[model samples]
Target: MRSIWAATAMTVLLAAGAAACDSSSAGPAPAGGLAGSTASSSPSATPDLEAGEELARGLDVPWGLAFLPGGDALIAERDSGRILRLRPGGGTPEQVRTVPGVAARGEGGLLGIAVSPTFSSDNLVYAYLTADADNRIIRFRLDGGDPETVFDGIASAGFHNGGRIAFGPDGMLYAGTGDAGETSTSQDPASPNGKILRLTPEGKPAPGNPTTGSPVYSLGHRNVQGLAWDADGRLFATEFGQNELDEVNLIQPGRNYGWPEVEGDGDTAGGRYTGPLVTWPVREASPSGLAISGGTAYIAALRGERLWTLPLNGDTAGEPAARLQDRYGRLRTVQVAPDGALWLTTSNTDGRGDIREGDDRILRFPAR
Candidate 1:
């Protein structure tokens, strides 16, 4: 039965518009902005809930978020480059003063955050951001201390600078990067952009990396904005495809995923690239900031304005089912909190979208 099901699935994907090289095929593009970008949908009926209890509103374009050890949350604002500490009860946000050298530009800034595994003792906070010349990763003590540039020299562009970071179960730092809007760079081995990078905590290359002394873990990614590991330690990632295909992939070290070459799943003989476990039309899914828990990968959709739940069995990813569709204006980030609930942030303030005053909010949902 499993073999028959796999064969049927393969046949269906082959018939769909999968490859980028197919002249007759065109992928889904976002409505008003770039080819794969999306616009805001109409607002849904507001739910009747207690104010300031489940959600903490009044955030100014919050981008990345990390949970502190003491049940507090630290969030970063994209435009202002400020990191705010959100207290449990949620009054005024306390600003952390030590962040330095953030180049806030198109889809760039302090983009992703992760607390150190030893943060209780080390007080270290790591951020992936765009600098004046390039996209880099930096680590700093949370108590208003000078930052140390751990890894430098990743690619950067006005868009597609893929700035999501997380500490993997191996105690190594993993970063997702974009192709910097250059199609060719996604397939290039030497370029850091359009790749998944693995590095040591101090910014050195991990010992078991596929490339010797190089941080490239996986290649041929357009813009990877989310990374998560399952309970079995299998890695999964969400990527923004160029025009039509947005992908959820079971990431493997040193594997090439077809980007400009092959968009989704079709002919593998075209190259040695791996196919996505699941693909969605780009208009329906510009996936970012994914979190995995209880055998499901929860993905935050930017242009799609939805939360996608993809069931996972080991390293294999099933079809993505949409949740909260058209309910949130523009969902930017989704994370699993320490308390096991899913926390989501809206991207209504992203400048490209229709800005609803006070529309940007952090919402928490019970984990299913």
Candidate 2:
């Protein structure tokens, strides 16, 4: 689906974003490596496989997951564009509402979900999906009412429509978008595709953006599928790379991550694009959704069919370890619940991989 370089930069950026922002503002941060660039050599500890438990099943190609404050989970179906709500204790999923204007061709459809931080008051939910002409992000009121479109007008294609949304610590909305299957768009600052976008609750550009209040935070990404923020307010993202390098990158406002120019950690022709903090071979990690907590970042792998654990020390990401490899086929999305547990979804019905009947399910793991 994505190039190896995109994957690596995605992971590194996600960790950086979480480690660099403030809990109250979600504003941009100074560009710098975490902890003076002293790379930590500690490897990820072996995960206790028995700790992960399946929480729900019968999901049709679930792609995105968002947790409500009351411990319920919202799940998105890629093909049907239906959003389902699952209560704790595991019962039948209730279809909340179907998203409108979704183009479910190739790797596009209902992709990412994020609830407003002030959900108790706002009752707002945001989603990123592929539209008929492009990829778009929209916010809807989820208080048992009709869905409303808040923002739209992103680029899309048959593949590489980076679709992930998250509310920053500042209560603003941040979206990760793909380059719409085109390599050059990643480097085009004018294009909304292949960039991390910062927007207010009403879909306007957040205050203090890179440009004079422009929505594009940073450019030069192929397909970004995950976003997260740590306790210190830093931001991180996961991206799918070209054939060779998949990336995890630390995201800085207005910084460029060389996508078509460079793959993995290397210099590019169009100036020095930032390299990934952590790079993985494409075969090992076609990482998607990412979650940061307890000084670690969790990445869900699609082609690799595993969960990768990366220990974090400030902005630097330590070596990563693969967990549950081959145990589940094509892990798609990962989210950190409000109670600090990790919720993951499987993507067996996406048509690109093996569709195991009842293989697409939700699993929860205790965050260590």
Task: Write down the RMSD of candidate 2 (Cα, Å).
Answer: 12.8
Each prediction's RMSD over C-alphas, in Å, is 15.8, 12.8
Tens-digit per-residue lDDT, 1-368, candidate 1? 11212343344345543322222213221011011211111122221112212355555567898888775777877766667676544443445542568888889888998999999999999998888999999888776556899998887888998988999999999999998888898888888888999999998989899988999999988999999998888889999987788999899998999877888776666558899898889898899889876777889898888888888887676777888888767888877766565667888777756665445667765432
Clashing pairs in 1: 27-244, 28-244, 30-37, 178-194
Q: Lowest-lDDT window of 10 residues in candidate 2? A: 30-39
Number of backbone collisions per candidate: 4, 51
Candidate 1: list runs displaced more than 4 Å: 1-54
lDDT tens digits, residue span 72-156, model 2? 8888888777777776555445566777777899889998888888889888888888888777777777755555666777877
Q: Estimate each model's TM-score.
A: 0.83, 0.84
Give candidate 2 regions above 4 Å deviation: 1-49, 268-271
